[model samples]
Target chain A: MLLNVQNLQAQVEETEKQILKGLNLEVKPGEVHAIMGPNGAGKSTLASVLAGREDYEVTDGSVDFDGEDLLDMDPEERARKGLFLAFQYPVEIPGVSNKLFMQTAVNAMREERGLPELDMFDFDEYAKEKIELLDMRADLLERSVNVGFSGGEKKRNDIFQMALLEPKLCIMDETDSGLDIDALRLVANGVNTLKNDQRSFIIVTHYQRLLDYIKPDHVHVLYNGRIVKSGGFELALELEENGYDEIIKQHQDA
Target chain B: MAKKLSPVAQKARDFYLHEAGKLGDASSGVLKQVRDQAQEAFAEQAFPTAKDEDWQYTKLTGFVQNHFAAVQTSEEVAGKINAYMPSFPVIKLVFVDGNFSESLSDDLNELPDGISLESFADTLSMNNELDKVFAGQDKILAEPFGSLNSMLMRDGFCLQVSANKALELPLYVLHVQTKAGSISSLRNRVVVGENSEITLVERYVSAHEEGAACSNIVTEIDVAKHARVKQVIVQQQNDSSYYFNNQFISQADSSNFNTFFASTGSDTSRHQNHLYMNGEHIENTQNSACIARQSQTVDSRSYTEHNDEHGFSRQLHKFVLDDKAVGVFNGMIRVDQKAQKTDGQMDNKNLILSNTAKMDAKPQLEIYADDVLCSHGSATGQIDENQIFYLQARGINKAAAMQMITKAFLLEPVEDINNADIRKWITDQLEVALAKTHLPKA
Candidate 1:
C-alpha cells in the first residue's frame, strides 16, 4: 500500500469543531480513489490534513505513507518525500518567475532523492520539455508565477507543476473548481499522461464531473467527516445521476 | 545678535572657523561667499527636535549629542579605501574623506566632447554656475544639517552635458570614509543640456567599522528641455555611520528624470529628494528600497511639485525593517492650479520582519487643479503567512521562501530599468543586503 490511514480524528486549529472523525482509508499503488461529498463535508479538510497544513490539527489517528509517519513531516518535507498537493487556488507571486519557482521546487525534491541539482541552463531545458509535454504556452515560464493568469491557466499550471514534480501520491483538492471544460480536459490529460504503475491519486471533489474525464478505480461517499459508503467506478455514475442528497440522507438515517 | 547654537551646531561652527581652511580650497572665489553666508544661517538654527513635525518619527538625539570632527586622511587609509572600490567598467570619480583623490580617479580626458566633468575647485575657478545652483539653497541652508553641509562641503564633481550629446558610459562617483569620529561633507552639481542624456551612479561606503562617523551631502541636478537623466544612489556605510543627504532636481519641458535610491546600512540617516517641474510635458520617476536592522533608523522624504501643465510623475518606495529598526517615509505630490492635466501616483509599502520593528509612512497628494489625476497610498504590515505557506507547500523551505518573497518585493521598484547590466548590478547589491538582513519566519 502507498498510503494507509486508521482511526483518523482532526479538527480546525484552536477550535472544538471536529472536521475529520475516525476517517479510515487505504490506497494501493497505481489506484485512483475519488472522494465525493456535499458542502461542509471533510473532503477538503482531509486533503489539508494530509498535506500537513498547520490550519488543521490532527487530534488522533496515525497516517503511514510507505512505512513512514506522514504527520511528522513539514509540508515541504512531505513534498520532497514524493507527496504533492495541487492547491485549489494557486498563489500569485508578483516578481518570482514561473521558471525560477519550479526550478527551486524541482531541485529541492531532487536533493532529497540524492540527485544532483540541475544548473540554470540544464533546468531551463528540462522545464521546457515538461512545458511542451503538457502543451502549455512557452511564455508561461517567463511570466510571474500565476500573476494575471486566467482561472483555467492557473489550474493547468498547477497540473503542469504536478507533472514536473512526478510525485508518487497526488492529492488534488478541487483542481477542477474554477476550470472551464477545455481546462478540465487539459488537467485530466496531464494526469492521465503522468499516471504509472507506482503512482497513486486521491481526488477530492464536490461534483463528479471531473471524475468523468479522469476515471477513478473506486468511489467513496464522504459525509459528516467519515467515508460512509465505498464502491467501484459505477458508484460515481450513480452519484452523478442522483447527486449527494441520497447518499447523505442514507448515512444520516443509518 | 546671533542665536545660541546647540552643542552639535557649535561643534560644526567651531570646526568651520578653525579647521575649514586646511580641509578645503574654499579660501577664495564663489565657494568662499557661499560658505560665509551658510555659516551665518547655520549658526542660527539648532538641530531638529522631536517637536518638529517632519522629524517626529526619526530620533536624532544620539547623532546630535555626539561630537564629530573633520580629520585628515593618511596615505595608508586612502590606499585601503581605493582597494575597497569596485572595478566596474565606468568613468569613476573617487573621493576619500570628502577630498578628491587624483591617484584613484580616472583621467577626465577620457570624457568625449560636449561632456565636461571637473572637481569643485576647478569648476569654481572657471564659471559662476555654482552661484545659480546655490541661488535657492537659502531655505535649505537655514535647516540644521543642510546649512552645516553647505558651510563645510569642499570636494565633489561638477558634470555638464552639452546639447545633443549622450554619454556612452555611466558615470560613477564613489565616496569612501576611513576615519573615525570624522565628518565628510560633499556638494555635487549636474547639468544636462537640451536633448542630452546621461546616467549617473553615486555610491557611499565606509572602510572604518569600529568608530562612529558622519557624511553630509548636497547634490543639485538641472535637466534642460528634451533632456533625460537616470541616477542611482546606493548607500552601504558602516552601522556606526550617520548619513544625511539632500538632492534638488529641476526639470524643464519634455525632459525625463529617473532616480533609484537604496540604503542598507546606517545608524541614522535621512535622504531628502525634492523635484521641481518648471516646464510643461515633463516626466519624472522616483523609486527607493531601504533595509534597516538592529537599532538603525532610516528616514526618506520626497516632495514633487508640478508647477506647469501636462506633467506626469510616479513614485514607489519600499522598506524592510527588522529587530528594533525604524523606517519612515514622507511623500507629497503637489499639483498647482496652473498645472492642468497632471497625472501622478505614489505608493509606499513596508514589510516589518520582527515584532519590535516599526514603520511610519505618510503619503499625501495635494492638487489644486480640477483636471489632474492623482492618487497616493501607503501600506505597512508583516510578511503574509499565506504567501509563506504557499511557497512552503511548493517544496521550498521557509527561509528560502521568505528570501524570494522579500527580494521580489524590494526589486519591483527598479524593474523598469532599461540597462540590463546596471540593473543586475543593483540586484547584486540588494542580494548582498538580503544576506545580512534579519528575515524572521512567519
Candidate 2:
C-alpha cells in the first residue's frame, strides 16, 4: 500500500465535535480513488487531518505512507516526502508573487530529494511547461498568489500548483466546489495528464460531474465520517441516479 | 535661580545657550521670531506624557530624559553610507549630523531644466521666502516636538521644480547618522510649481549600531496648482536610537500629493503627517507601515483636512508588532463644511505576532459637511489562523509561513510605488527586518 489509514479518529479542535470516527482507508500506487460523501460526512476534515492542519486533532489513528509513519511528520515534511493536498479554498497570499511562492516550495522539495535547485530563469522555464499544460493565464506567474483571481481561476491555480509539485500521493479536498463546467474540465484534464502508474490520487469531491472527466478506479461513499460503503466506479453513478438519501438512510437505519 | 528644569527642558536650554551660536543660529529676523516663539512653546509644552491624549500609549521618558549633545560627523564617516545605497538612478543628497555633505551627495550641475535642489540654509537665508514655505507649520509650533525641531534645525533641502517641467528621476534626500548621544534636527521644504511633476524620496538612516542618538525632523511641502508630487520616506535606524519626523503638506488647486512612509527600525520612532487640501478636485494618497519588535515602540499619526469640494484622500496604515514590541496608530480625518462631495477613507490594520506584543489603533473621522463620504476603521488581530494553515498545508514550515504572511502584510502599503527600484528596496529591507525580528520563528 502506498498510503494507509487504520482506525482514524479525529475531532474539531474548537468544538470537540468528532467528525471522523474510526475511519479506515487504503490506497495503492497509480490508483485514483474518489471519496463521495453527504453533508457533514467529514470529507474536508479528513483532508485537513491528512494535511496536518493544526485545527483538527487526530485523537487516535495510524497513517502510514511508504512504510513511514505519516502522522509523525510535519506538513512540510510530508510535502517533502511527496504528499500534496489541493485545498478546496485556495488562500490569498498577497505581496508574494506566484513565481517566488512556487520557487520556495519547489526548491525545498528538490533539496529534500538531493536534486539541484532551479534558479530564477530555470524555474521560470520549467514552470512554463506546466502552466501551458494547465492553460493558466500568462500573468498568473507575476501576480500575487491567488490574489484577484476569479473563483474558476483560483481552482485552476490549485491544480496548476499540483502539477508543479508532482507528489507521490495527491489528495484534493472538494476540488470541484464552486467551479464552472469549463473550469471543471480544465482541472480534471490537468489531473488526468499528471496521473501515472507510479503516483496515486484520492480525490475528495461532491457531484459526479467531475468523475465523468477523470475516471476513478474506486468510488467510496463516506457517510457520517467513516467509509460506510465502498465499490467500483459505478458506485458514483448509483449515488448520482438515486441521490445520497437512499444510501445514507439505509446506513442510518442499519 | 529659576525653577528646576526637567531633563528634556534643560537639554533644550543647553542647546539654546551653548550650541546655538557655533551652529550659525538665526538671530534678529522673522526666523528668529519664529524660533523664540517656538522656544516659549517648548517651555510650555515640555516633553509629552501619558496625560496627553496623543502620547498616551507612547512614553518618551527613556528617549528624551537623557541629555544628548551635538556632534559633527567626519567626511569619511559620511561617505560610508554610499555603500548601503541600493543600485538605482536618482539624485542623492546626503546629510550627515544635520549638515549637508557635498563629498557624499550627487552633483546637481548637469541637471534637468527648471529644477533647483539646494540646502535650506543656503536657499532660505537668501530672502524671506522661508515665510511662505514654512507658512502652515509655524502655526503648529505649540506642538512641543515640532517646535523643538524648528528651534534647532540648521540644514535640510530646499527643492524648487520650476513651472510646467516634469523630472523623471527621483530626488533622494538621505540622512545618515553616525554620532552617538547626539541630537540632530532637520527641516526641509519642497515647492512643486504649477503643472509640474517630480518624484521625491526622503530617507532616514543610522550608520551607528549603538548610537542611542535622537533625530527630530520637520518637512514642509508646497504643491502648486495642477502639480503632482510622489514622495517615499523610508526610516531604518539603529535599534537603540530615536526617530521623530513631522511632515506638513499644503495642496493647491487640482494638485495631487502621495507619500509612502515605511518604518522598520529604531527603539522609539514616531511620524506625524498633516496634510491640508486647499484646492478643489484634489486627490491625496497616504500609505504607512510600522513594524516594531524587540521592545521597540513605533507610532504613526496622520491628520488630513479636506477644506474644498471634490477632494479625495485614501489612507492605509499597517502595523506589525512582534515579541514585546508595541505599535500605535492614530489617524484623524476632518471634512470641513465647504468641502462638499469630499470622499475620504482611512483604514488601519494591525497584526500582533506574539502574546506579548501590543497594538493600539485609534481612528477618528469628523465630517462637518453633510454631502461628504468619510469612513474610518481600525482592526487589531493576530496572524490569521486560516492563512497560516493554508501556507503550511503547501509545505512551508511554520516560521517561513509566518514570515511570508507578514511580508504580504507589509507589502500592500508600499507595493504601489511607481519606482520599481524603490519598491524592491523597501521590500528587501522589510524581509531582512522581518527575519531579524525572528518573526518566522513565531
Candidate 3:
C-alpha cells in the first residue's frame, strides 16, 4: 500500500473541536480516489492533517506512507518524503520570487534523494520545461510568489508547483473551488499529464463536476468526520443525482 | 541662556579647543569662524540625557563618560584596511584615521575634465564656497554631535563636479580605522554643479574587535540647479566600534539627489540625514538598510524638508535585528506653507529575529500646505509564522526559510538601485550577515 491510515482521530490545536473521528482510509499505487462530501465534513481537515499543518493535532492515528510513520514529521519533512498538498488558499508571499522558492524546494528533495543540486542555469532550464507543460505565463516565474495573482492564476500556479515537485502521493484540497470551467479543465489536464503507475492521488472536493474531466477509480462519501460509504466511480454520479442529505442520513441512521 | 555643561560636553569642548589650531588652515578662514561659533554653542548646551525626546531609546551614558583620544593614522593600519575594499572598479580615495592617505590611493590624474578631487584644504583655497555652505547651518547647532564634528574634524576630501559635466565612473571614499579607543573626525564635501551628474560611495571599515573607538564623519553635499548625484554610504565596522555621522544634503531647482545608506556593523551606530529641497520640482530619495545582531544598536534618523513647490521625496528604511540587538528609526517629512503640490512618503519595516530583540520606529509627517499629499507608516515585528510555514511546506528548513524571508524583506530597499554592481555588493553583504545569525524556528 502507498498510504495506510488506520483509526485516525484528530482535533484543532488549542481547542476542543474534534474535526476527525476514527477515520480510516487506504490507497495503493496509481489509484485515484475522490473524497466528496457536503460542508463541514472534515474534507479539508484530513488533507491538512496529512500535510502536517501545525494547527491540526492528531490525537490518535497511525499514517504509514511507504512503510514510514507520516504523522511524526514536519510539513517540509512530509514534502521531502513525496507527500504534496495543493493548498486550497495559497499564501501570497511578497518580495519572494516563484523561481527561487521552487528551486529551494526542489533541490531540497533532490538532496534527500542523493541527487545533485541544480545550478542556477540548470534550474532555470528544469523549471522551464514544467512551466511550458503547464502553459503558465512566462512572466509567472519571475513574479513574487502568488503576489498580485488573480484567483485563477493562483490556483493554476499551485498546480504548476505540484507538477514540478513530482511527488509520490498528491492530496489536493478543494482544488476545484473558485475556479472557472477553463481553469478547472487546466487543473484536471495537469493532474492527468503527471499521473503514472508509481504515483497516487487523493482529490477532496464538494462537487462532482471535476470528476467529469479526470476520472477517479474509487469514490468515497465522507460524512461527519468518517468515511460513511465507499464504492466505485458510480458513487460520485449517485451523489450528484441525489444530494448528500440522503447519503449522510443513511450513515446517521446506521 | 547660561548653563553649566555636562562632563561629556565639557570634554568635547576642551578636546576641540585643543585641536583648533592644529586643524585650521590659512585658506579655511570661514571654516575656522564656523568652528568657533559651534564651540560657543556647545559650551551653552550639554550632552543630551536619555530622557531627551530625540535620544529617548538609545542609552549613551557609558559613551558620554569615556574620553576618546584622537590619533594620527599609521601606514600599517591603512594597509590592513585595503583588504576590505569593495570589488567594484572606481577611483579610490582611502582615508586612514580621518587623515587622507596619499601613499595607499589611486592617481587623481585619472579624473575627467570639469571635475576636481583633492584634499579638503586644497579645495578651501580654490573657492569661498565653504562660507556659503555654512551660512545658515549654525542654526542647527542644537545638535550636540553635529556641532562637535564641525569643531574637531582635521582632514578629509573635497570633490567638485563643474556645471554641465558628467563623470563616467563612481568615486569611492573608503575610511579605514585601525587605532583602538581613538576618535577620528572627518569633514568631506561634494559639489555637483548645474547640469552635472556623478555617483559617489563613502564607506567605513574598522579593524577594532572590542575597542571603544569612534569615527565621527560629516559630509556636506550641494546639488546645484538641474544637477543629479547619487551617494551610497556603507558602514561595516566591527561590532565593538562606534560610528556617528551627520549628512547635510541640499538640492537646488529641478535637481535630483539619491542616497543609499547600508549599515551592518558597529556597536552603537547612529546616522542622521538632513535633506533640504530648496528649489521647485526637486527629487529626493533616501533609503537605509540596517542589519544588526548581537548586542549592537543601530539608530537612523532623518528630517526631509520640502520648502518649495512640486517637490517629491521618498524615504525607506529596512532593519533586521536579532539577538539582543535594538533598531531605531525616526523620520519626519515637513512641507512648508508655500510648498504647494508636494508629495512625500516614509516607510519603515523591521524584522526582529528573536524575542529579546527590539525595534523602535516613529514616522511623522508635518504638512502645512493643504495641497500637499504626504504619508508615513512603520511596522516592527518578527517573521510571520504563517510565512515561515509557507516556505517550510516547500521543503526548506526552518532556519533557511527565515533567512530567505529576511533577505527578501531587506532586498526591497536596494532593488531600485541603478548600479547593478552596487546592488550585487549589497546583496552579498546581507548574505554575510545572515550566516552569523541563527533564526529561531517560529
TM-scores of chain A across candidates: 0.97, 0.97, 0.98
* lDDT tens digits, residue span A1-254, model 3: 99999989999997959988989999999999999999999999999899888888999979999899999888899989899888888888878999999999999999889999998999999999998988878888899999999887888888888887889999989999999999999999999998999889999999999899989999998888989999998999999999898977777735
lDDT of 1 by residue, B364-423 (tens): 989899999999999998777777777787789988899889989888887867777778
- Write down the TM-score for model 1: 0.94
Going through the candidates in order, what is chain B's TM-score? 0.93, 0.94, 0.93
Best-fitting candidate, scored by DockQ: 1
DockQ of each: 0.72, 0.61, 0.70
Ranking the candidates on DockQ from highest down gives: 1, 3, 2
Q: Candidate 3 DockQ category?
A: medium
Highest TM-score model number:
1
Q: Per-residue error at B70 for model 2, in Å?
A: 3.4
DockQ score, prediction 1: 0.72
Model 1, position B181: C-alpha lDDT score? 80
Comparing 1 and 2 on TM-score, the stronger one:
1
| Ten contiguous residues minimizing lDDT sum, candidate 2 chain B | B16-25
